[model samples]
Structure formats: C-alpha cells, structure tokens
Target chain A: EAGVAQSPRYKIIEKRQSVAFWCNPISGHATLYWYQQILGQGPKLLIQFQNNGVVDDSQLPKDRFSAERLKGVDSTLKIQPAKLEDSAVYLCASSLGSPLYGYTFGSGTRLTVV
Target chain B: GQQVMQIPQYQHVQEGEDFTTYCNSSTTLSNIQWYKQRPGGHPVFLIQLVKSGEVKKQKRLTFQFGEAKKNSSLHITATQTTDVGTYFCAGLKTGANNLFFGTGTRLTVIP
Candidate 1:
C-alpha cells in the first residue's frame, strides 16, 4: 500500500500572507489528521477528520489555521495571514478507525514564514 | 485538556551503551503508539501497546506500558549509530478518538 502523500514539500511566504498545503492520505483510511511540528517541538494536532466529519479541532487556531478533508480522502490545511511563529512542518497522517492500527505519516510540508 | 510528556529532552550515548526514554500522560490511556523520526524525515510508526503493563520488544529495543496506563518507556540496548533520531509516544485517551502526543526525546548515538 502507498504511504500518505503530501505536496509542495517546501513553501516560503511572508508574514500576513496566505498559504495552503495539500495531503492525500493512504487509500481506504477513514481517519485523517493534520499536525504542526515546530523546529524543536513535538507535532501538535491541528485538526482531525473521521471520514468527512470533523472529530477534533480544539487545538486549531481558527482565526489563522483551517483544514478540511473533503470526500474523506484528501485534506488541505490553509493558514491565512501566516504569522512568523507559524513557520513549521505541517504533517498529515492517516489510520484505520481503531487505534490498534498505527498511523502512516507523509513527508510533510516545511513552511517558512518570513 | 490532555498532555503527554517525555523525559530527557535529549541524550547522547556511546554506540554500544544503553539508552531509555520515558513518556507520561496526564490521563489514563487506552493505548499508546511509538514513532521514530530521523533528522530531516517524518515520523514512522515503531510499535503500539494496548494492554496494561504490556511489554513488547523488537530486536534490541523494548517498550513497556505502565500498569496505570498513564506512562510508558522505550529502552534500547547496546545502542547503535543507526538508532539516532527523536522518539515520540502518542497516547489515546480513554473514551477519546484522537491521540495526545508526547514532547519527544532526541537521541544521539556516538560512533
């Protein structure tokens, strides 16, 4: 089976600019997650989707960060008016509904906010 | 709010020495998953523990889940240079559907 796929391996944008990263989870996965990892920190969950419905977004900064998993297959995370502190690696991962099956993560998009 | 923390933010060991990293969660966890992220790479799943006081091993590495299910540990014996990377523990809170990730422990094995 193919691993989760992410696009635009790297991105650079100025502060207050908008940027988006795309992700295609592993085929047949019913749960998708978006995580943001700072240079020296652990990956923080931004949003999660169970099929087409959202399961979690409590940590997402709604004002600046938004994510959607349409059709329950692919997802896109957008940061509007990106802040300097928002510069980090955006990772996407997917797994079966049960926690028994571990997640498969993508390469991730390294975003740099100047 | 849920939080998972790992101790020894960073550690350096000789190629043939032993190393260990610990993960603790604020709430009881139903299951725990471990991942390793090499420099310049994304995290890759290493193993998962679902039972209380469970102990699993792969090659020279050992994983243990506390009896309380709120803590876990990963031990590497005779560490090799190839074991260099950050280890993370993600815990699934009881009755919850999402995972709470740990701070991660970065290990450097000197050859």
Candidate 2:
C-alpha cells in the first residue's frame, strides 16, 4: 500500500500572506488528521476528519488556519495571513478509524514565513 | 484540554547501552500510541497499547502502558545508532477521535 502523500514539500511565504498545503491520505482510510510540528517539538493536532465530516478542530486557529477533507479522500490545510510563528512542518496522517491500527503519516510540508 | 508530556526532552547514550523514555498524560487515556521520527523525516507508527499494564515488544523495543492508563513508557535494549530519532507518545482519551501527542524525546546514540 502507498503511504500518505503531500505536495509542495516546501513553501515560503511572507507574513500576512496566504498559503495552502495539500495531502492525499492512504487509500481506504476513513480518518484523516492534520498536525503542526514545530522544530524540536511533537506534532500538534490541528484538525481531524472522519470521511469528509469534521470530527475535531478544537485546536485549529479558525481565524488563520482552516482544513477540509473533501470527498473523504484528500485534504487541504490553508493558513491565511501566515505569521512567523506559523513557520513549521504541516503533517497529514490517516488511519482506519480504530486506534489500534495506528496511523500512516505523510512527508509533510515545511513552511517558512518571512 | 488534555496534555501529554515526555521526560528528558533529549537523551544521549552510547551504542550497546539501554535507553528509556517516559510519557505522562494529564488525564486517563483510552489508549496510547508511540511513533518514531528520524531526523528530517515524518513520524512512523510504532505500537499501541490499550489495556492497563499492557506490554508489547518489537525486536529490541518494548512499550508499556501504565496501570493507571495515564502514563506509558518505551524502552530500547542494546541501543544502536539506527535508533536515533524523536520518540513521541500520543494519548487518545475516551470519546475523542484524535490523539494528543507528547513533547517527544529525542534520542542520540553515539557509536
């Protein structure tokens, strides 16, 4: 099986600019997650989708960050007016709806805000 | 909000020695999952423990879930350079769809 896929391995944007990262989770996965990982820290959940419907987004910065998993297959995370603090790796992962199955993560998009 | 923390933010050990990292959660967890991320790489699934006092082993790595269900630990025997990476413990609380990750423990093995 193919691993989770992400596009634009790297991105650079100026403060207040908008940027979007795309992710394609593993085939047949019913649950998708978006996470932000700062250097030297663990990945923080930004949003979660269960077959196209949001299951969790409590940690997402609604004013600046937004994510959608359309058709329950691929997901996109957008950050509007990106700030210096938003410069981090955006990761995407997917699972089969059961915690025991664990997760398969993507390569992630490394964003740098100037 | 639930929080997960890992001790010894970083650890350095000589090859052939043993290494251990601990993870604690602010609240009881339904299950605990571990992941390993190599330098410049994304996290990869390691193992998951759902029952209290559950212990699972893979090769030289051992994962344990505390009896209280609020803590976990990962132990590596005869560590090797290939074991270098950041170990993260993600806790899933009851009624939650996502797992809360810990601060992570970065391991460096000197050969």
Candidate 3:
C-alpha cells in the first residue's frame, strides 16, 4: 500500500507570513494526525482527525493555526502570521483506527521562517 | 497532561555492541508504540506494545512494556550501521486521545 504523502517537502517564509501544508493519508486509514517537531524535540500533536471529524485539537494554536480534513481523506494544516519559532517540521500521520496500531508518517514539510 | 521521558539523549556504540533505551511516562499509558527516524527522514513505525509486562521481538530488536504500563524499553542486539537513528517511544495515556512521544534517543554505530 502507498504510504502517507505530504506536499512541499520544504518551505520558506518571513515572519508574519502565512504557510499551508497538505497531506494525503494512507488508503483505508480512518485516522489522520498533524504534528509539529521542533529541532531536538519529539513530534508534538497539533490535531487529530477520525474520518472527517476532529478528534482532538487542544494543542493547536487556534489564534493562528487551523486544519481541516475534508471528505474523511485529504487534510490541510495552515499557519498564518508565522513566527520565527514556528519554523519546524510539520508531520502528517495516519493509522487504521486503533491506538494500539502504529501510524505511518509522511516525509514531512520542513518550514523555515526568516 | 501526559508526557513520556527518554534517557541517554544520544548513544555511540561500536559495531556489534548491544544498546538499549528506556521510556518512562508521568501517567499510566494505555499503549506504547515505537518508531525509528533516520537523520534526514521522517519517523517510521517499528512496533506497538499494549499488554502489561509484554515483551515482543523483531529480529535483533526487543521491545518491553512495563507491568505498570508506565515504562518501556527498546533493546538492540548486535548493533549495526543500519541501526543508527533516533528511537522514540510514543505512549497513549489513559483518558487521552493523542499519543505523546518521548524526547528520543539518538543512536550511532561506529565500525
């Protein structure tokens, strides 16, 4: 089966600019998640979606960041007015509906804010 | 909030040496999953452990879940250059819906 796919392997923007990332989860997977990984740190969950509905997004920065998983398939994560600290890797992962089941991660989009 | 902590931020071992990394959680975990990430690549899922005091093996890699479900370990036997990467333990805490990943242990195998 094809793995999870993410768009724009790399991105560069200035502080206050906006950036968006897209993800296509593995076929037949019912859960999709977005995570942010800062240098030297583990990936932190930003949001999780079960099918087309959001399961958790408590860590998401609602003031500037938003994500949507439309049609229970593809997803998009956006950050507006990016800050220098926002420069990090944005990872997308998918699982087959059980926490006990491991997730498949995408290549991730590396964001660098100047 | 649930958090997973890992020890030995980095480890350098001679080829053929054995290595191990530990993961501890501040709260009980419903399950734990392991992943490996190359220097420039994304994390790849390795395995998952759910039962208390469970031990699973994959070739030279051994994974263990503590009896309390709050700790875990990953041990590699006869390390090789192919095993050089960051190993992470992600735990799903009870009552929480998201997985919390540990800081990760970076492994280096020198020939």
Candidate 4:
C-alpha cells in the first residue's frame, strides 16, 4: 500500500510570512489529523478531521493556524504570520477509523521561520 | 485535556543490551498505541494494547498495558542499531476520538 503523501518536503520563511502545507492520506482512510512536532518532542495534535467535517481542533491556534480537509480526501494546513516558535515539523496522519486503528504519518513538512 | 508522559526522556544503551521506556497518562485510557519515529523520519505505528494488563510481543519488542489502564511500557530485548529512534505512546480516552501522545523517549544504541 502507498504511504501517506506530503508535499514541499521543506519550507523556510521569515516571521510574519505565511505558509501552507499539503497532505494526501492513504487511500480509503476517512480520518485525518494535523500535528506539530518540535525537535526532541512528541507530535502534538493541532486538528483532526473525520471525513470532511472537523472532529477536533481544540489545540489549534485558530488565530494563526487553520486547516481544512476538503472532499474528505486531501488536507491543507496554513499558517499566517508565522512565528519563530512555529518553526517545527508539521505532520499529517490518517487512520481507517478512529486512532484505535493506529495512525500512519507522512514524511511531514519541515518549516523554518527566520 | 488529558496528557501522557514518558519517562527517561533519552536512553543510551550498548548493542545487545536491553532497553525500556515508560508511558503514563493523567487519566484512565480506553486504549494505548505505540509508535517508532526514526531519526529524520515520521512516526510509524508499532502496536496497540486495549485490555488492561495486556501484553503483546513483536520480535524482540514487548509492549505492556498497565492494570490500571493509565500506564504502559515498551521493552526492547537485545537492542540493535536498527532500534535507534524515538518511541511514543498515544492514549485514547473513553468516549473520545482523539489520541493524546506522550512526550516520547529517544533511544541511542551504541555499537
């Protein structure tokens, strides 16, 4: 089976600049998630989507971060006015159902804010 | 707002030695899953434990879910260079669809 696919393997932008990341989950998976992982730390959930509807976004920084999984297939995460602290790896994961089935992550988009 | 914590943020072991990392949750978990993230790579699911006091083994790796359902552990026997990576435990709370991940533990195996 093909693994989750992510685009723009790496990105670099100055603080206050905006950036976006794209992700394509495994085929037939209905649940999608976006996480931020800082160096030496675990991935933190930023948002979760069950199909096209959002299941959770409690951890997302709504003011600066926003994500959408249109058509319940591909997802995109956008960060506006990026801060230096936002310089981390943005990971996208998917599961057949809930996370109980475990998750498969993509290569992730490494963002560097200068 | 549940949180999962991992002990021994980092561990260094000699090849052929044993290694273990612990994960604890602030509340009872309905299930727990483990993942391995290689250096410069994303996390890959390893296993899942549902029932309390459950134990599962894969090759030289052993996974245990605590009797209280709030803690878990991963044990590696005869650690190898290929075992080098960060191990994470994610716990899903009852009636919740989201999985809360632990801080993770990085392992370094010296040849």
* Model 1: CAPRI class: medium
- Name the docking class for model 4: high
Best of the candidates, DockQ? 4
Worst 10 residues of 4 chain A by lDDT: A97-106
The deviation in Å at residue A47 for candidate 4 is 0.6
| lDDT, residue A47, model 4 | 97
Task: List clashing residue pairs in candidate 2.
Answer: none
- Tens digits of lDDT, candidate 3, A1-114: 999999999999999999999999999999999999998899999999999999999999999999999899999999998999999999999999966678899999999999
- Per-model DockQ against the true two-chain complex: 0.80, 0.83, 0.86, 0.93
Which stretches of candidate 1 lie above 4 Å from their native place?
none
Model 4 pairs in collision? none
Clashing residue pair totals per candidate (backbone < 3 A) = 0, 0, 0, 0
Per-residue alpha-carbon lDDT of model 1 for A77-112, expressed as tens digits? 999989999999999999988556988899999999
* Best by the TM-score measure: 4
Instruction: Say which prediction, candidate 1 or candidate 4, comes out ahead on lDDT.
Output: 4
DockQ of 1: 0.80
Candidate 2 docking category?
high
Candidate 2 on A73-112: residue-level lDDT in tens?
A: 9999999989999999999999998656898999999999
TM-score of 1: 0.98
